[model samples]
Target: MNLKDTAARAAILGTLHKAIGDELKAAKRELGEGLRAAKQETGTQKISVSLDEGQDIGTASLVQPKAEAAVTDAEKFTAWVIENFKSEVERKFVTSVKPGFQKKLLDQITAAGVAEWADPETGVIHDVPGVEMQGRAAYTRMTVPDAGKQAIAQAWQSGALAHVVLPELTAGGAE
Candidate 1:
């Protein structure tokens, strides 16, 4: 309203603006110093931690040597099976007719040993020496039971099952 009032308000506004600017500058300087100090401290400190102490540092991972060994062993076992028991394995895995039919046929053959045979179509009854039935041998597939699988898995997960020791080497030192 008046010249004096206007001049006084302008001076106060200018001072307030300068104070805010100075405060901002000080805050920025403090932040920069804090960051620099943190960086320097981190650089100076070498984080040497031994995981063997069983410390709960953070989220841990289960590294089972037995699991890896089991996989290797499984590969070996598969190879052995393929090499040594190829025919047996094939017979075991082969899918064919139902067992009931084969069993019934075998039972009939056994019962009709050295008996007379009658041809259904010709109606000719003839004495036979023996009934010889020849076919591929049937074998039931051998599967690892669920309980066995669970046991193997448990063995794989158990620390006592297998242990692999890695050689320790010094870092940033002469070999």
Candidate 2:
């Protein structure tokens, strides 16, 4: 090849390299911005729970909870976990895979019976209320305050807790 042709080819290659480099840098910047926006719009965190029978009852979660009312010190920090679990479970079954997969596992438990002290989705023993003799006893603590625990129980039993738990925590804010 002649010197002039070799030089011309080198210049064209250099120009192409610079153009590609600029595109790569711009794409990286756009990706960074998109990540930031996503972080702001929908932050995410992991949650774990164990409520199986003949096993320990525990939950682990990382959330930024506001106001002691949102969760008292006596309660487990996994309140957000319960909330999210309910939401994910009740999202509805679809023909496609993915979201419905979790629903399939959770839907094994169905609401049933009179007292309703169990979780319909996971069949776990969720919050149940203390029946204050219903007609005679002034105060009883078999489950929770008079009818307080029962309300939670009924909700879990009938899937009502899904609506209540999610909005309360999401509005109060979470990770």
Candidate 3:
């Protein structure tokens, strides 16, 4: 009700929120493994778990795995792209080609995330130089129906929480 009390409550709630988030990640990992195993054994790609059978709840489903790529060396990648794929490079010169713009290696690599980069002329698949690809396993994706989301929002908006916005706390205590 008071400033000090609200600050204390918010501090405690913040800690609890972080702990809950860590636990949720671990739980999700376990659930994803189970989902993957089930899909493998049943030869099914689409697997979902109902949050609650009798209640209107969210559902968690196993989605396809994706790959992640990151450019570790920007200069090396830029040189490689210029030598290998000239068309992918963008040149911006003010006076001459001496101080021209750098290649868009990061942009091109990011746009080509989780996909193969092929040579334009040769049509041969080539790995982007200085870019390392990491394969991410299929993870469980959770989805809440629109109706459930609306109900949850309404409930929260109508509750005591509506007026309990966390204020900017001072270093040692409430201002």
Candidate 4:
């Protein structure tokens, strides 16, 4: 490249860099001012006042307590049910047998999208459904439907499940 081209490119880059730096500084100043305004509006600053009787009220400061996170009874019950029944549901799906009697015992692997059948007497593989001559299978993950949520909710309301209670905190002060 020529010297003129190089100089022009450098000048453009320098102008862009300076513009970006100035914008960043302006943004930081605006953010600091906004934060200060918000703090003052929220009563984070201390204030002192003098009464008519020449009595001075000491510096009064506002103290805001951070809210504590809590879990509800429904959430706890849902967690408990999932922990207890998740494995059982997965096992049932994995070992599920197709209805009706066939000459061969077929185990349907839904995730693999294939029905694996083997003869009991000869112990030979036979009749894979949806398998091509090239032996390629289309696999799909199985998802279990959440059909028990209503039942669980009903059971909880009927007192079949234990209820959970969370502690509540309140702030009190004299005016």
Task: Indicate which candidate wins on lDDT.
Answer: 3
Instruction: Give the poorly placed runs of model 1, Cα more than 4 Å off.
Output: 42-175
Candidates sorted by TM-score, best first? 3, 2, 4, 1
Question: lDDT values of the candidates?
Answer: 0.40, 0.39, 0.59, 0.39
Q: What total of clashing residue pairs does each candidate reach?
A: 0, 4, 0, 0
Tell me each candidate's TM-score: 0.22, 0.25, 0.48, 0.24
Which lDDT value does model 3 have at 114?
40
- Residue 118 C-alpha lDDT in model 3: 60
Using TM-score as the measure, the top candidate is: 3
Q: Is candidate 2 or candidate 3 better by lDDT?
A: 3
Residue 29 in model 3: lDDT: 85
Q: Please give, for residues 26-137, the per-residue lDDT of candidate 1 as tens digits.
A: 5546544554454457732122212233322222121112111011233443344445335423344743323453344335444555233444558665443323433332
TM-score of 1: 0.22
Q: Please report how far candidate 1 places residue 74 from its true position, in Å.
A: 69
Ordered by lDDT, highest first, the candidates read 3, 1, 2, 4
What is every candidate's alpha-carbon RMSD to the true fold?
A: 30.4, 27.8, 9.1, 28.6
Say which prediction, candidate 1 or candidate 2, comes out ahead on TM-score: 2
Backbone clash tally (model 2): 4
Model 3: colliding residue pairs: none
